[model samples]
Target: MALTSIIAIYALFWVMSAFVLLPFGIKTHDEAGLPKVPGQADSAPANFRPGRVLIRATIIAVVLTTLWVLNYTYGWIGVDAINIFEKPEHLKR
Candidate 1:
């Protein structure tokens, strides 16, 4: 793939990774035994850390992007491997 294509793919993976890890390792004010402000939402995080989330998301995105690049280069998994609309060749008459 071209350099730009790889960069786009990595960016997509990074955003997805960040969203997937958003809810993990989070603690609400109630859970952390911290009193919430009058206007604060009940689900607001008490110790949300963007740095940690970014670091974790970066690591996950790197791993996923590496596998995706390898797969694109090596054809380890192809379109046919995940085609679920039709029966597989082996299962078809």
Candidate 2:
């Protein structure tokens, strides 16, 4: 029981870190009204790429969570908790 609780806690942390920690590492350009640099044309829109960062971070988080779930559940694919749903047989009932 303790092991299952620990696994749940760890998985929670992993998902939360993916959504929080990873995005925070990315630098978003919020500099509106700032002066344009030399060689920078005023007509050109700022090349802020928050979408790319968000997509990449989401991908990474999904991959990490998938691995964690697979490892914990011994090959289970898309579910969250491991011990509660250990075997395919358990789900049949």
Best by lDDT: 1
Q: For model 1, where is the 10-residue window of minimal lDDT? A: 84-93
The per-residue C-alpha lDDT of model 2 at residue 31 equals 43
Q: What are the per-residue Cα lDDT tens digits for candidate 1 across 12-73? A: 99999999999998999999999999999999999999999999999999999999999999
Per-candidate Cα lDDT values, in order, are: 0.94, 0.57
Off by over 4 Å in 2: 1-46, 75-93
Error of 2 at 68 (Å): 0.4
How many steric overlaps does candidate 1 have?
Answer: 0
Clashing residue pairs found in predicted model 2: none
Q: Where does candidate 1 stray beyond 4 Å?
A: none
Q: How many steric clashes between backbone atoms does each model show?
A: 0, 0
Q: Candidate 2 — number of clashing residue pairs?
A: 0
